[model samples]
Target chain A: MHVLILGAAGMVGQKLTTALIADGGLGDQALTRLSLVDVVEPPAPAAFSGAVDRVAADLSLPGTAEQVVASRPDVIFHLAAIVSGEAEADFDKGYRINLDGTRFLFDAIRLVGDGYRPRIVFTSSIAVFGAPFPDLIPDEYFTTPLTSYGTQKAIGELLLSDYTRRGFFDGVAIRLPTICVRPGKPNKAASGFFSNIIREPLSGHEAVLPVAEDVRHWFASPRAAVSFLKHAATLDSDRIGPRRAISLPGLSCTVSDEIASLRRIGGEAVVARIRREPDPTIGRIVAGWPTNFNARRAAELGFVAETRFEEIIEAHIEDELGGRFVS
Target chain B: MHVLILGAAGMVGQKLTTALIADGGLGDQALTRLSLVDVVEPPAPAAFSGAVDRVAADLSLPGTAEQVVASRPDVIFHLAAIVSGEAEADFDKGYRINLDGTRFLFDAIRLVGDGYRPRIVFTSSIAVFGAPFPDLIPDEYFTTPLTSYGTQKAIGELLLSDYTRRGFFDGVAIRLPTICVRPGKPNKAASGFFSNIIREPLSGHEAVLPVAEDVRHWFASPRAAVSFLKHAATLDSDRIGPRRAISLPGLSCTVSDEIASLRRIGGEAVVARIRREPDPTIGRIVAGWPTNFNARRAAELGFVAETRFEEIIEAHIEDELGGRFVS
Candidate 1:
């Protein structure tokens, strides 16, 4: 199977690339070739003994989607999107890259017209659900996104379902939860604290807790996200039926639970590194986010996630911390 | 107040234009100027003594949206769209006109830049919902459109909400039910039978009933649709909160109800013009349409519709048949 990964230079994309290369295949088909695309040229895999092509091209540009899709890989992982903050800040840039880019890619495949139907795995976000949500958002809750990035993702989901219904391509959109222990420097995202408090403290650095300890949010690990992408790629499209968007399973827990997990893993010293600094702006923002989901449809389809935060922290320790923590 | 109607030549648009002229205003503001646009130049109102401008402009064309919005009409009714059947058949044309055209119009308003926030009444359709619907689809039901037209309208709804949230404009998307007792000749739309059965018989002609009497569907009169548009225009945006798309209230009844109403209105002689011919192709197509909606939100917001089929037929008789039907 030939694989193409868009946004291959990003964090999730890079992890997915490494995982796919190590697995040496997707499902039953052997990986014979790989194509990587992003705004920045992605690194070619060193370990993989297969044909690899890398390209640095902005998808928003005219004909860029067509050029990238010319090879028509068997599996396409579309993870490229402007994050919520940036998209909210620069509306035009966000829509151009996220909405127009995704549409361009879909249209490119459609214009191919030679019965070349590839399995596409698109990464949607929990941001699609705004404030005033049910305690556990069901598989059928309405999507009224408050942010531009969320709107773009929701639009992509609609298009994905429509194109799939039209037999243009088989597609699945998985709405991923916030990735805990994100294995990178903290960014400006409002939800960044969820990862920072865990990742920074375990690395012997102080991290600010923007919201209250009781504030809850949904979470999954980087490894789980990659697994979801793989699972969605190989699953029977008929099982998904018409609604192509699926809210994936994630561990729903309060900030207290995360702290407890950290304390258990790296002792009290590591937990003490989390500073008490309440920012109401971030608090209000995080308060509107979805804390839990039924995710019944995705679960029924065999998609799984860690039920306990301890597992998530352990994965981070083993994968990012090289099996050791600050304590 | 200046009002711009993008599809002023269509049936509902013409009715709305006439009603606005007759009312001499929308709500408290006096109608000072009226601008009409469509693929074909709309006819100027002969009775109204107001500044009337007519233009034959395609919104999908570059610079056309900018030119149309240059006047900055205080109330803009964006009713332009390619119908469902055409959109499903021609993918590129549908996206270009329905999706790109709407975006261009929105961006043009955003570009106006000097705090020009107009009240935009957009006409969405019930096509946004597909089969496997509950007995009564609620206001919060997720939109999973099966047709390309539905997909485009769904995208428009998302964009409308996002742009409204950003304070670029005050927008309301009214998802109109199938307009029953249509005045014109029968068309190729699968749902045309709903109107054809009643309309053709009243016009002294035979009408075909292609489905069983038990096939229930949602409906409203053209006059009710115009009223919904008017109500949506003058509504307090704050009351609407964040979600801008509304499933307008409509009468839900089976074909039996329609025939029974026709019998009471025009006697068995007029009903005898009906011909029973089952077209399985059309039956299957109509079977996939949404049968009902709760429409609680729209009702709460004071958007009313005819509850009885007799009232709907009376409306068509009063509005289109010169207060007389062939008996």
Candidate 2:
């Protein structure tokens, strides 16, 4: 089986590559070839016997989509996107890369014809929903995206579903919850505090809390995200029906919950590293984000996630910190 | 006030033009110029003193959008699109015209940046929805369109919402229900029978009903649709909030209800003109369409529609049949 990973240089992409290689296959099929694509060249997999094609390419460029799909990978993980902050800041660039790039890829695949259909797993985001929603948003709730990035993702989801229905490809778009305890250097993103407050404190470093303790949000670990993508790629298309965008199950929790989880695992010294600093700009932006979801459809479809924020943190420690953190 | 109608040659376009000319303005502003565009040249409205620029243009072409928006009409009614049947048959043309054309127009308006924000009323369709929904689909029900036309329109809605939120344009996407008693020659579209049944019978002609009488669907009159476009243009944007697309209020009734209404409006002689020839293909297509909608948001926002099928038939008689039928 051949697999392609777009945006293969990003955090989730790198981890997914490692996971796919470690497993030696996907969905019970032996991996014979792997194609990795990103704006920047993806690093070669460490210990894969498969034919590896690591290339740097921009999907928005006219012929780039055609070039990438020329190999006709059996499975495609489309994770490429300009992050929310960058997309919102640079409107034209965001639409160009996120919207136009996605269309380019989809069109290229469709034009290939001759039954070169692949299992396309697209990474959508919960940002596709806006505020003024119920506490637990159901699967059938409208995707009224408030951000340009969300809009582009929503459009991609629509295109993917349509293309799939037209029999051009078998595609599934998974709307991921924000990954908690993200293993990386803390960034200045509004939602960065969700991960920063947890990761920094656990590592015995100071981190600022931007929102209130009661401010709740849905989350899953990066590991869980990778698993969702894999499950989506392999799931029976019959079960997905016409609506290909699945709202994945998530762990709903608040800042207080994160702190409690940290205290329980990392001790009081780690918990004390978190300093309260409320920034209204981040507060306002975060306020408009959906905090919870029923995710009943995904649950019924056999998709799962970390049940608690504690599990998310433990996963982070085991995966990123080698099962240890600073006292 | 200067107004532009993108598809001024089509049925709804023509009606909106006549209505605009009859009223002499939109949103209480005196009309100065009317810019009409379509693939075919839009016929000039009768008895209008205002300046008229009617051009035959294809919006899918790159430079056309910029050229049309150069004049920058105060209110732009984007009503151009290939019908569902055509879009479904030709996938490339559908995306090119419906998706690319929309983006080009939006970008053109955005690039004319000098604080030139116009009220853009985009005419979306109920095809943006698919089956497997609740009997009374709410305003917030997810849009998982089952057709390529629906997919393109749904994508357009997302772009309009995002662009509006970004302050690129003040846009509103109104999802119009099937326009019943559509005043046109009988066409072979799956949905065409809905209009043909009522229209042909009233015009002293036999029409084929391709589905069971129990098959229900949503509808509104062409006049109501015109009013919807007008009302959407003038609505206070604050009431719309961030979700720019609205599932407009529609009268939901079954084919039986339609026949009963037709009998009442056009008498027994006209109802006898209906021939039952159940085509399984059209039946399968129509079965997947949504039948009912709460449309509470549209109602709350002061957008109204016929409550009964009888009223819809009467509307047809008044608007299309010159207040008389084959009775």
Docking class of 1: high
**Superposed model 2: Cα runs more than 4 Å off:** A187-189, B187-189
Model 2: pairs clashing at backbone N, Cα or C within 3 Å: B1-B30
lDDT of each: 0.92, 0.91
- What CAPRI grade goes to candidate 2? high
Model 2, A1-327: lDDT tens digits are 999999999889999999999989998999999999999999988889989999999999999999999999999999998888788788889999998999899999999999899999999999899888997999999998878888999999999999999999999999999988788896434578899988998788899998899999999999999899889989999999989999999998888999999999999999999999999977877888899999999999989999988899999999989999998
- What stretches of model 1 exceed 4 Å from their correct place? none
For residues B2-84, what per-residue lDDT tens digits would candidate 1 score against the true structure?
99999999888888999999999999999999999999999887588889999999999989999999999999999999888
Please report the candidate that would top lDDT against the real structure: 1
TM-score of chain B of each: 0.97, 0.98
> What clash count does candidate 1 reach?
0
lDDT tens digits, residue span B96-173, model 2: 999899999999999999999999999998888999879899998999998888999999999999989989899999
